[model samples]
Target: MSQRKRGPFVSVQLMSRWRNIVGLNVGMGEFLHKYPHVFELFVHPLRRNLCCKITQRMRDLIDEEEKIVKEYEPELLQKVKKLLMMSKNGTLHVHALRLIRRELGLPEDFRDSILRTHSKDFRLVDLEIVELVDRNESLAKAEVEKWREKEYVDKWLSEFETSYAFPINFPTGFKIEGGYREKLKSWQRLPYLKPYESKEVLRVCTCGGIERFEKRAVGIIHELLSLTVEKMLEVDRLAHFRKDFAIEINVCELLLKHPGIFYICTKGSTQTVFLREAYSKGCLALPNPIYVVRRKMLDLILLGHRNTRSLEDLEEIKEERNGSVFRTNVGGRRDGDWIVPILDSYDQNAFGSLGDINDSKQPFDGCESGRN
Candidate 1:
C-alpha cells in the first residue's frame, strides 16, 4: 500500500483501542451495581471459606476493571485504587470501602477505594492555580493593546522630527567647505562680517546656495524673504557651532530644546511679543514680510546702513521736515518718501555695497533679524 493509505489505517486502530478502554470502565460499574451485597460479604473472613476460588478470580477482574476506568479518569481512579490496594484483604477494608460506595453513590468497587485515599487539600490547591492563570492572561492582553497605541503615537512624532532637520546626501569623494563663509561675505558685500563657523565641518543644504556662490548672490538674498514655516523646519536639527539656522517650528516639544531661532513665518499674524520672549533667551526672532511691512514707518528704520539705501531702499532720504533733518522715503513711495540713493561699490567684500548685497552666495541675508 501507498504511504498515505497506510497512515489512515494506523490512526483508526489507535483510536479504536482508546475508546474500548474507556467503555470497559463504564461497563464494570454497571456490573457491580447488580449485586452490591456480594462485595460487602468480603468484610467477613469467615465467609472466605465459602468463596475460595471465586475470590481470587474476582480480585483479578476488579484490578483490570479499575485499570480500564483509569485510562479515562486517571486522577480520580488513582485516589480510589490507592485506598483499596493499601487496605487489609478482609472485613475492615471491605466494610470501609462499602460505606464509601453506598454513602457517596459511587461505583461499589471504586467509591470505597476513592474515599480511603483522595486528598481534599490537593483539590483546593489546583482550583487556586486555575484562577491565577486566568487573571494573568487577561492582564497580559491589556498590556499588549496599550503598547500598540503608544507605538502609533511615537511613529507620528518621528515623521515630524525627521522632516524638521535638514539631511543632505553628497556624491562620494567630493569635498566642499572652508571657503563658503568668505564666499558668502564677499557676495553679500559685508566685508566685516566674515564667516565665523562654530564647527570645523559645515553641513551644507541641498538648496545649492553654497554651490551657486559666485553667480547670483543678489537673487539668493531676495529668496530668503519667502521661506515657509514647513521649509524652515528642514534646518531645525542642524548642528552648528557658529550661527544656527533659522526655522519656524509648530510642534510645542521643540520649544523646550533651546531653539536657536524662533521664527513666526505666518503673514499678517501678530507675533511681536512672542518673538521678544524668544529674543530674551538669546534666540533670534525671524518674522516674515507681512509683519515687517505693516509696522509703523518708524519701526522700519535700521541703524546699520553702510550706504544711503538699504536692500528695501527705504532708509536714506534726508530732508528738512517739521524743523528736523530726518530721512524720508522709508517704506515706499505711497508715503511720499524719496527714493534712497543706491550705494555704488565694485569690491564684493566691501562692508555694504549695492553690487554685493545683490550677490548670489548670500541669498539668505536680511530674512531673520534679532529684536532690539
Candidate 2:
C-alpha cells in the first residue's frame, strides 16, 4: 500500500511506478495488453495521458456490492459506532478514516449518513471529524466476554481445542517450535479485558499499564478487521494507525501474542494479518453480501486469467438483455456463452488458509507478460 493514499483508480503510468505490488515484471505496456478485460485503456481528455481504468463491468459489480452493504447497514453502523467510541472523546478524523472505508463497506458520505440516518448514535463536528452521540464503551468487551465464555467451555477438551485451534495453514516449512504448545496453554488462560476498563498497576507496559494497552490495541484491531470484507488487512496499513489509535510500537509482537485471535501471514512480500476466528477452512464462515460481491469480482479476474479470450473475439461480443457481460464461444475456445454471475465462483475452501485472495493459485510469479 502507498504511504500516501491514492484513489482506487490510478493512471496506468502511475501504477507502473510500483512494479512489485502490481506484479509487473515486464514493462507495463506489454502487461496491459494481456488483461484488457480487467483493465481498459483510455486517454485522459484533458491531460491527454493514456491511462488505464477498471472496466465499466467492474464498476457495475461494485455498485451491486454496495447495495448489499447498504442492506446490512445496521450491522456496519454499529461497527463504525463502536470504533468511534473506542477513540478518546469519541471522535475520529475523517481523513484518517477514508483509507479503510472501502474495505469496511462504508459509503464515502458515511459521516453525513451518521448524522442524517443514525443521528442518535453519531454526529459530524466541524465537517472534519466524526463524533459519537452515545458512547457504548463496553461494546467491544461485551463481544470478547461472550467469545471468552464460549471458549472457556471448550477448554475442557484441550486436545480438540489444540488440534482445531483456529487452524492456520502457514505456507510450507514454517516450523512451530516446541514451545508453541506451552505458549498456547498460557495464552488461553489470559483474561479478556474490557475496552473501556482502566488499569491500575501493572508490570507490563512502560506506557503505564501494558495489559491495558494490549487490550485496547486488540479491541481496535479487532474492530477494524471485523468491518473488512475479508477480516484481513495489510499490517503496514494498521501500523499507520499505531500512534493515531494508540497501538503498540511493536505491533507484530502484540499480534503474535494472540495467536488464537490473529495470524500474521507473509504470503506476499508485504505482511498481512487475518482474524482467525472469522475464518473456517480457508473461507469466511460468515460471509455477508459484500464478501459475496468481492468474491465475484475476484472470479472475474481469475476466470479471465485462467481462460484467456483474445481481444479480437471480445471486440465482437455484444450486450445482453441484462447488464451482465457474456462472451460468445469463438474458435472452439470455450463452450457457449456464460453470464458473469455475481455469485458464481467462490471456492468453499478458499479462505481456509487465512483469507487467501486467490485460493486456487498463488499470485502471479512474474509481473511482465508475453503480450506485445
Candidate 3:
C-alpha cells in the first residue's frame, strides 16, 4: 500500500507485510495478482514476497464511483427514512442494519454521511437506535399498496379505503393450481389492519379467517422487508418477533402456502423469504446509494486476469442480479427468466428429511394460534 521511488506504483518490500494485515481467506498477494487492471504485482529487491500498488486509472475510477454515491445521497435517505418509520418504534437496532450492510451498499460512514447530514429527518437517539424524525407516508405503501388498490378495484370494486392488498410478483413459470388463485383472491379480499391492531379483531370478521391471518401475516412480512434495502430477509432474523408479528411458529408452512406474496429461497445454506413485489425483473426496483459502487466492484471481479470474462457474461449477471443472491447462479434454471419455482413442504427448510416429505401432503395441523 506504500509507494517506492523509481519503482512500480507500490513498493515490493511491503507485500510480505500486507499478508499479515489481510483478514480474508484469499491472500492480499493473490487478490492483487487476480486483478491486473487494479494492481501491478512484482518481487521486491530486499524481500522475496511480491509487492503491489493500485494503478492510477483504478484510483480515478474509485474516486469517480465515490462521487456517484455522494450524488445519490438523497435517494439513500429515503430508504433509511422508510426503514425507521416501519420499525417497532421510530427506531431500529444498528446491529440489524449491519447484517445486510454489504447487500444494501451502505457506506462505512453511513451515519456520518447520510444520517447525520439529514438530522431533521433522522436522529441517533440512544447511541444504537436510528429514529425517524417525522412520519409522512402511509404504512400500506411500505410494500405496494397502489398495486393492491388497482387489484381491489379490478376484482371486487370495493369503495372502502385503507384497504390495500399486497400485489404478488409471482416468479415466472410457476404453475397456478385451479383453486390456488381463487384462495389468494379470497385472502386478498380480507381487511387490511395497522401494525398495532389486534389479530383477534381480524377474526371477528373472518369467522374462522385462517385466511385472514395469512393476509395479515403478509402485511407484517411486507413491513419487515420494507425496512431492508432489499425486500428480503432470513427467516431466523425475524424469529423472535413471530408472536408480535402474528406469524406462525414454523413460518415456512405459512410462507410456502402463500407462494404469490412470499418466495422462500433455501439457497446460501440458509432460508430467506423475499417480497416478490419489490423487485422488477430480478433487480431491486429501488437502488441504494452504494449500488453504483458495488457495480464497479462487480466489473473488476467479473473481469480478472486469472479468469477473463466476456461482456456478454457480465451483462447476463447484470440482467439476473437481485438482492444478495444471484438468481441465475443460485437457482440455475432456464424454464423462465427469474422464475421462482414453488417448493412444496418437501424442501429442506419445510421438512426435516425426504421421509418426512412423504407425510407433507397429510394436512399440516393448525398448531399456531389464530391460524385455527
Give the best candidate by TM-score: 2
Q: Higher-lDDT candidate among 2 and 3?
A: 2
**lDDT to native, each model:** 0.26, 0.56, 0.53
Pick by TM-score: 1 or 3, better one: 3
Please give the lDDT score for candidate 1. Answer: 0.26
Q: Candidate 2 on 1-372: residue-level lDDT in tens?
A: 431222255677887888888676798867776665567777666677777766666677878887887788887787777667556456777766676777777887776664457877877777667777876654644344455445547545443343222323222223456776566544333343434443332223425456545755776677668768778887777776665455646887787766445667664466677765565434455766676666556545644444455544444434343423334432222313433321122233432321112222211122211111
Worst 10 residues of 2 by lDDT: 363-372
Ranking by lDDT: 2, 3, 1
List candidate 1 stretches off by more than 4 Å. Answer: 1-250, 263-372
Position 37, candidate 1: lDDT: 20
Show model 2 residue runs off by greater than 4 Å: 1-28, 40-56, 115-119, 137-143, 152-183, 196-212, 267-269, 305-372
Question: Residues 1-372, candidate 3, lDDT per residue (tens digit)?
Answer: 333452445554555466657554575566676776567566665665566766554566677666866776666677666656544466776656666554344666887777778889888877667787887664325445654455456555454422645544343335555786556555555675544343455546445555655656666666667656556777777564464344565777777766555666665357777765455433445645344344444544445663334323333443323443332342222224432232211111222110111112211111121111
The lowest-lDDT stretch of 10 consecutive residues in candidate 1 is 127-136
**Which candidate tops lDDT?**
2
TM-score result, candidate 3: 0.59
